[model samples]
Target chain A: MAQWALAVDLGGTKIEAALVDAAGAVLPGSRFRLPTGGGSSSAELEAGARAVIGAAYAALPPGESLLGVGIGSAGPIDVHRGLVSPLNLPAWRDFPLRALAEEVVPATPVVLRIDGEAIALAEQWVGAARGSDNLLGMVVSTGIGGGLILGGRALAGPTGNAGHIGHVEVGGMNVPCLCGGTGCVEAVASGPATTAWARAQGWAGSTGEDLAASYAAGDAIARAAVQRSGTAVGQAIASATALLDLELVAIGGGFSRVSPDLFGFIREAIARRSPFPFVAKVRVVPSGLSDEGPLIGAAALIHRADYRSEV
Target chain B: MAQWALAVDLGGTKIEAALVDAAGAVLPGSRFRLPTGGGSSSAELEAGARAVIGAAYAALPPGESLLGVGIGSAGPIDVHRGLVSPLNLPAWRDFPLRALAEEVVPATPVVLRIDGEAIALAEQWVGAARGSDNLLGMVVSTGIGGGLILGGRALAGPTGNAGHIGHVEVGGMNVPCLCGGTGCVEAVASGPATTAWARAQGWAGSTGEDLAASYAAGDAIARAAVQRSGTAVGQAIASATALLDLELVAIGGGFSRVSPDLFGFIREAIARRSPFPFVAKVRVVPSGLSDEGPLIGAAALIHRADYRSEV
Candidate 1:
């Protein structure tokens, strides 16, 4: 009988659940999602989690045994406590996410991991970072986040917050970030941050899409904003590569799609800014997974031996 | 029959070899050393290595069996090719340190790693970070170097160069480093760098020790220089902690001892500069090992299963 795992992906805006097989494929019609915005209360989040988990479990095949449930939540999560304290969701502070998932799938193992780590696992398992023993997977949407796979294993630190790359300071820029830090890559490189910078620079763009269109139109200000964002990201990557000796970085999310040249900009900045030959040699690539990347990575927590959460 | 491993530690100024037991203790009277500085040629290094290795082996007890050889050398080393290109020793560029060691102890399993990594392993095994599974070991000497033990394993990346912390930029400084990068921690916090800064600031200090003495006597410029170096180290540590979610950082080397309050300065800087709670919470401590740290760490490459070199 084929083995299956219940995968849950909880983000600031939504919560998703799916039944995935050993091969990392989400079962057809097993995926479900529920809205979970900043206004969501603890009760509402718990209800929403249960509803999607129920829908996913209902679609599980009859003969396949459910090995476990894997959850990837927006961090910072306390894997030891099975709780989540995601930055964006104010109402769900210290919510017992793992316990709630366990209630839905009683007597089965439940694993909780940060969303970035899940994405890295998916990419390393079946996407762009396949065959790489040391890789970094990053998302550059409304917020920037990343995960690491070093020595062919996920690096979940003492608090399960190892790959919090967005918070690392970006040199020369003293801009305050939402994480209470200054000069963070997320403050300069995230889609919203880039769009905000473009707006402040007298470019008449209010959204990332508008900025993308402006960039495509060859507007100098839009180009400058995008380059600045890419430079910040590249500088952060250079530092990470210098520290981790990473082989590749796979970037995904909305803002990274603003321009194909964005990657070129990032690469150029890394080469120019990095002092070590090893760091300069690290490759930057786009994530090969689709929208199901999160769910697939969540499932990886149970399916892949190396990525299993310590708790 | 006591099992022992031959440990070799190669630095900018000297090469040392010794026999180490499974308990991380170096055998008395087995340790030998040879001078190796910038003026030393590849042939000299080879001869020195053989001499040390032969002396160490000659002192091996009657019933003890040599398990293997573990060598930690000044990097950046090409572990894949068993070669070393130490920045200080230009004559040893691409020099096959591993091959030379293997010649001294043929048919034994040979392991190679950066000297910083060796220190990390030693600390993790029996030094300041004994109980901690995730820690960083740093050397704040003439040049800054570091190593990491993450997830209960020594993190030697694809090239055995995972923890090259010195090269990471210290945001505000634009000083160029010897490694072709600007604003590196080594450029600002190294002993030579701090002394140079002190000299440029009209301080008559000729060495780190002189600066320490001046600071002890309440010299303002000397205090400023020491504080600046400590602050730079702390800022770099903050960034590294932010990225790695490290539990502890054990600092060693001559310059770190320049001031009793150096660690306090580093800690205060980290707390002040870091925006994230986790990064600020990481502990910075002194290395627990004596001068035998490098040799113990080199031996750990063979003694500790987690630190075994992939090559």
Candidate 2:
């Protein structure tokens, strides 16, 4: 019998699969990746899920026993029903993800959750927030997403969308977000949004990587854009800290590498604006897992069985 | 071999003590109360704590074993050091609460937490948030205080103050709060603050209860005052729902009962202002454990063994 579970992390840009052992270690030779795009239809999305699972299954020894499947999707998931309808993934409207996985790997239970919560769980179990009871994990990539682990448990509210930090309004920007909120963190500071904001401010940079390069080169517009994103993020974290009394905020994603100076600026902003000293102490740090975060976090679900999972 | 624990709920106006069991049910004839005031010095506060604890102890059988002690104090407490220097407790700075409790009951272990977190814990253990993975417990009394439980654990951040929701900035409020923040929900909506705001607005009410009575008697000014507080609270909750992805906000304390119309107004305001369907689904409800919330929640600290106890 295989002493491992299957973990799938579905992102807006990629799909990752891993066979995670009972100890949360990703088994060697069980990790693979696939591309994801905005143009995919519902059928395409289902097929993508099947292809990844099938490939992972095939790599395993024939007739090996398997644990349940844990799938972490982008956002707006219904954990109870294993439904997903992420705003960025138009094809996944109310998609029965667990049922589809059940069809692919018959009789193995499928546990569905938002990617943000999965990352938080990962952090709580084995990453930056290890040994901490209260943690907030944020993904500041093409868009901002977050999850909370309070009192040693992942907080999945009704519909499994608690910790949707992107939609919480920050001041001074009325830019509309895909989540239908105005003045949200994503509206002002997601990778595309930050780049767009910089472009509108007459910056010549076209990409986040280019923006980062220019920022390292001390370009004025690029620095301002990065600072702006950091400011919004810092303000949001301050508010979150005040509201939730979080111990640390573990931030990850490609866009978060804009500059170390940006994090300094965020700390300054939070100190100046926040009222509560406890909230002010909430550290905003980088994710420890880096590229391996999703896989490790996916594995965390099976490893931390009492925290989540059915049967 | 007895399972009873001594539970203490310390507030600005009163200190209550009760003997509770493993299930958090208060023992008959074991609950007692005492008055507290602002001028209380460290010695006086210690005396007060001793008095209440003494009363509960005296009420119990002399041979009964007291398992432990749990203290739910008003902020701000240093849970790590077991010290309390609450804003409401003026003469209290760096007071060793657990040490003092040890002086009272040397052999018993002591657990210290903010009253807000205790309330949240109470709800999580036996009240409204019993089965919820993500819960926010709010006390809408003299000031708005809160505690959070995400994924079945208390969100006690660094310093053991995880759910300090009062300082969360509510947009458009120009009011200043004791926490030094302007536009805070507490500044605009807390009991004394709301009453003061109403009085400043030409309403002759002397108290929140009086204001509630006036509103019940159809006084326009009183009704408007209540509505204003409700609106601010609703807006804050809406923001919290967006940020935290919370399922239910269980509100308690005297101010919450200002009107039956309060939660209804809050729900309406949230629905009107929420940018997403999920945010609108967030429930605003009264706490199931009202007067007994703190004591019950203090015992939940033992019952919810998933959370590590400082005691």
Candidate 3:
């Protein structure tokens, strides 16, 4: 019998689920998603989660044995308590996500991990970080998040938030972050953050898309904003690499695509700031997986032994 | 026959070797040391290392079988090439310390690791971090250095320099560090750095010991300097905990003992800076091991299975 893992990804704006095989390919017609947002109530979230999970399970192919279920959710997750208190979902404080998912498929094991970790696992499993034993995978959209793969295994810290790179302070910055920290990388490097910085500098950009277009047209303010964001990210990465001795970083999300030379800017910042040869040697590359990365990484929680946590 | 490991610790001013049992205890009367300073040439270092290794071997108790040899050296070491280019030891650049030690005891595996990693392994094995799976051990003496024990194993990155936390920049500081990095923790928190900062501020202290006395006497400049160092350390620890989700930090070395309230200052800074609960909850404790920590940790590379690397 073919083995399949039911992978669920819960984000601020949506809930998605899909069935993935051992080869990392999603099963035909097994993917589903439902809307979830800031205004979503607990009951609404619960219903949305159930609908997505059930829709994906119903599409499971015949003669296939369900291996397990893996869930990747926006964090501040409590892997110890199998609970999630995502910053974006105030109505679902301490939500028992694992138990709720288990109730949908009784007698099957359910694993929950932070979304950033799931993305890193996906990249390591079948994406750009395929051969690297130590890597950092980052998403730089509306919010910045990251995950670490160290010693060829996912580094799920005590609370399953080991790779919270976005929250680490970048030297010389005093910007306040939504995460209640000052000088956070996300405060300076996220898509919205860059756009706002550009707008504040007299640029007429109101969105990341506008900023990207202006940057392509060689607008000075747009270029400065993009460079500032890239520099912040690079500084943060340098500190992480210095502490963890990472080999590479895989970057994705909308802001990272603002300019093709964004990677070059990040690389230059790292070289200029990183003192050690080992830290400066870390390579920054584009994420290998596409939009399906989160689901695949969630599936990896069951499909790949390296991504599994004892908790 | 009882199993024993020959442990060697090479520092800026001296090289020491000792025999350790599987239980992590150093054998009495089996330890020896030799001086090697900046003026010492590679030939002198080789001769000093040979003498220490020979003395430790000769003192090996009867009926004890040598398992292997473990060596811990100052950064930045190249574990891949078994060479050491210690910043403090200018005379030995890319010195093949591992091969030199191996030649002393033919056919026995000689494992080399950064001194900071050896200290961390020692702490995790039998010191303050016992039973904690993820911890950081740091030395805050003449120059700051650190090591990480993650998932109950030593995290020796590709270059054996994963835990070089001293070089990581502390946000908002622009102090020039000896490691060629700006705003590094060591630049602001190391014993010499703090002393220098205090002196520049009109304090009469010329050394860490003098600063400590002045702090004990309630000198304002001295207190500020100590607090500054502790704050920098705490901020750096917050960043490390945020990135790695560490459980505890064991601090040792001379500067950390400058003031008893240094720990309190560090805790306060972490609480003030760490945006996440997991990072703020990390315990800061005194190192369990004494001066022998480096030697015990060096032995751990051979005595403890978890600290052993494939390379």
Model 2 clash pairs are A151-B153, A151-B154, A154-B151, A155-B151, A162-B245, A163-B244, A244-B162
TM-score of candidate 1 relative to the true fold: 0.95
User: Which candidate wins on DockQ?
Assistant: 3
Docking class of 3: medium
Estimate, for each residue in A1-311, the C-alpha lDDT of model 3 and write its tens digit.
67999999999999999999998989978999998998999999999999999888888777778999999999889998889988888888889999999999777899999998899989988899989888999999999998998888888888788888887777777787655555778888899988888888999969888998999999999999989998889888988888888999999887789998889888987887544788889999998998899999999999996555555
Better of 1 and 2 by DockQ: 1
Q: Where in model 1 is the C-alpha error above 4 Å?
A: A62-64, A178-180, A273-275, A309-311, B180-182, B273-275, B306-311
lDDT of 2 by residue, B184-299 (tens): 68888999988888898899979888998998999888888888888778867876887766778899989999999988878876777444777887788898895898888776
Best by lDDT: 3
- Which is superior by TM-score, 1 or 3? 3
Give the TM-scores of the predictions, in the order they appear: 0.95, 0.83, 0.96
Measured by TM-score, the strongest candidate is 3
Report how far off residue B137 is in candidate 3 (Å). 0.6
Q: What is the lDDT of residue A291 in candidate 2?
A: 83
Residue A262 displacement (Å), model 3: 1.3
True contacts kept of 2: 0.46
Docking class of 1: acceptable
In terms of lDDT, the poorest run of 10 residues in model 1 chain B is: B302-311
Error of 2 at B210 (Å): 5.6
